[model samples]
Target chain A: MTKLIVEVQDLWKSFYIRHNRNDSLKERFISLFDGRRRERREVFWALKGVNLEVAQGEMVGIIGPNGSGKSTLLRVIAGILRPTKGSVTVRGSVAPLIEIGVGFHPELTGQENIYLNASLYGLTRKEIDRIYDEVVEFSGLEDFIDVPVKNYSTGMYMRLGFAIAIQLDMDILLVDEVLAVGDEAFQRKCLAKMQEFKERGKTILFVSHALELVSELCDRAYLLVNGQVILEGVAREVVACYHRGQIPIRHE
Target chain B: MGSWMRGLTRIIRYRELVRNLVAKDLKVKYRGSVLGLLWSLLNPLAMIVVYSLAFQYILRIPLENYPLFLITGIIPWNFFSGAVIASSEAIIGNANLLKKVKFPLEILPFATILFNFVQLLFALLVFFPAVFWFKTGVTPLILLYLPVLALQFLFTLGVAFFLSSITPRYRDVRHLTEVALMVLFWLTPIIYSISMVPGKLQPLIKANPLTAFITVYQDIIYWGRLPSTEMLISMVLWTGLSLGVGYSLFRRRQRVFVEEL
Candidate 1:
């Protein structure tokens, strides 16, 4: 049996929605003296009782409509956001490609950015040196390696971002809609690389709106709605359930 | 591992990321400007000119080599103020990365402080030429500047970590820091000699944490002697207290930073 790589149990995350613009310290200081200076905040639950489990070497896609807490769930699993009332435990390191080119500076050269981005993912310089040529080659930005990234075309920019992200040595890679940026050929290359990773027994947690891609790439899928995991099963079955408008009844 | 050991290991592992981030900040700082890195030197030089003219020429201070005196205090002051001010916005400014990436939030402030430290090193390059040209009486005490610098760095790091954690929730912290720094600047003896202050005011001067650091710089760089025993002791105490308070506060508050942001 494949080992479980990610185990999230009954996750809940809430955010405060301030009713007034008095969140600033200056405003708070004034509110202390003025009787009429009242500030209010409402709690917003982004994720309510979310539970999920992904096995080792499985490509699990989280599908949900906009503002449905898919991204929040991914962020929590990646350890970026603390859950309000649940535990998200992953067995090993996570490389989060939530947004391409996260720490990329526009002024730096492509080579420089590749180093910076990889280092952010926790790759040592020696490890980066080993993978530098492969990343540059995969991005196909050989001629522009020395040129600053600001001058590169949008496609080149995304290609570089994707290349650096995919090359990191991680046990589980958390991907979130990053593949939507590049062109068709680049997307094909990315899919091929994903296939390679799957073959190498690396677990993948993918979040995307692309249903066809989900059914094609993922071994199993999760459907989330209104902050809860409404359905989970075989990839095509879950996709069909979502298409049939079979959102689970809201708990509240 | 113990919590402190865990923290130490985390920082040790992320040392490369810190180095790269620091390098990126330095490069981005001077990337598009015409004067580029030279502006780091020219900025403090301009401050010296203005302050020297205002105090030495206009106010008619009796002290000789007044510009040198001002530079001594000013250079280190710039490092402290620059790190503290930048750190207040460090986490808020990197909301994008904070929202997506799962790494130490403390790295943000640590990297920002280190960035300013690098710029201060460059500014120190300018100081050496001024020191040699003015013939500010070289001595063995200059070697002692390293220990003092390391202590100041710890104090600055502690404050940076604390401020960065707090700023996201208290957005006015950024503004308050600017005003506080301005007030603190005048309170510290950067532009004038400590002896010039009246005897009654000496104790007041001693109370300010920055006074010890600025005086240490003034001692080795200007007076060419070791810092007084009292100053050294206060430096260590202040460094320890600031680091202890700052780090604990930062640790307590870091978990909620993303939500606040």
Candidate 2:
């Protein structure tokens, strides 16, 4: 049996959106005496209670139609967000490549961002120095490394971001749709790297909409609908169910 | 360290976030500038030239070593106020990063104030030469202002963090900040000497915490005298209280920042 690395018990999250109001302060003041409208109302629950567990070295893919709480669940697992009402127990160091280059400074050079990104990922300067060459070489952008990242093309930016992320040595890696950003070759490279990570026994929680990638990479998968886990089983079976729901099958 | 404390300890625990944020701020600031970070010094110098032109050339406000007085007063005032304005928006501007990355909320405002302090240090390099040009005598008492400055920085940070945390919630607060800053500028004795204010007005200005702090600053740099014991107590107390309250508010609201953002 694989060692368990994460435990989730009935996680729930909701948001209180103070309703939007139009009309200026003056208009509101004028209407106040007549009671035109006082306070706005309502709350949105982005996630109902959600529960799941993934063992160490398991690559689990989470698929859902939009607003099915996939990203929210990923956020809670990464500890970037708090669940409204449940316990999410993560056992090891978790590195979330949630978004490509979320902290990249526009003016800083690629080399500078590498250090900043590495530091943000909990790596010390010395550790970044050790892996600096590997990061740049994998990024395939040695010539542009000195240039400010603002000068980088989308591909260059994604490459640098991916390079920084892939170098992070963490037990649990939460990958969002970052691999979907770059060119075909780069995407293939990212897939290969994820495969390499699998070989190295790093656990991954992959969230994406691509059925083929989900089936190919994830040993176990879940189909989420309306902020609830509607189905869970083998990846291919889940994908088959997901696609079947997408297009109606006529019975003879 | 204490139980009454709520948020500052949390910020201390995430010290890495603060360091990275400070670095990110410093890098992003001059990133687009052609002169790079020289922009910080250029701003104070430009202000000095314009103020000198107005006071010395046009109005002819005749006074001995007047340029020295203005530079000493204006540079710190600029640092303080610039930090206030910048810090008040620190968390709001980094809303995206705050929502995405789970770090201490105080890190954002701390980073803002820290970067401003760095720029203030740069501005000081330009400011010190004028002190000697005016031939002001250096006294041991002048060194006393370092602790005073450390206090003032803390106070500004506290106020900035407090204001920034609330500003995003009630956006009308941002519009009113300019007026508050203007009031603070006049109260702090930036453009004029403390002696110039009437004796009755002096007490009122002294009552303004920032003015009391600035008075300490000008005392050492201009008059070469140490600030009185009462002034020192006031400065330290103000920094402590503002930071205590400001950090608390920031800490309490931090978890909710993503939704607010």
How do the predictions measure up, each by TM-score?
0.95, 0.90
Compare the candidates by DockQ and give the number of the best one. 1
Candidate 2 docks with a DockQ of 0.33
Error of 2 at B228 (Å): 1.7
Put down candidate 2 lDDT per residue, A57-171, tens digits, no spaces: 8899899888878888888988888888989999888778788787788888898888877766556567888989999999999999999999999889989988877887778
lDDT per residue for candidate 2 within B82-173, as digits (tens), equals: 88888768877876665665655666787788878888888787678777777888778877766777887889888887988876666556
Against the reference, the lDDT scores of all candidates come to: 0.88, 0.78
Q: For each candidate, what's the DockQ?
A: 0.73, 0.33
Q: CA shift at A91, candidate 1, in angstroms?
A: 0.8
The candidate that achieves the highest lDDT relative to the unseen native structure: 1
True contacts kept of 1: 0.72
Candidate 2 chain B: worst 10 consecutive residues by lDDT? B1-10
Q: Report the number of the highest-TM-score candidate.
A: 1
The positional error of residue A141 in candidate 1, measured at the CA in angstroms, is: 1.9
RMSD of each: 1.9, 3.7
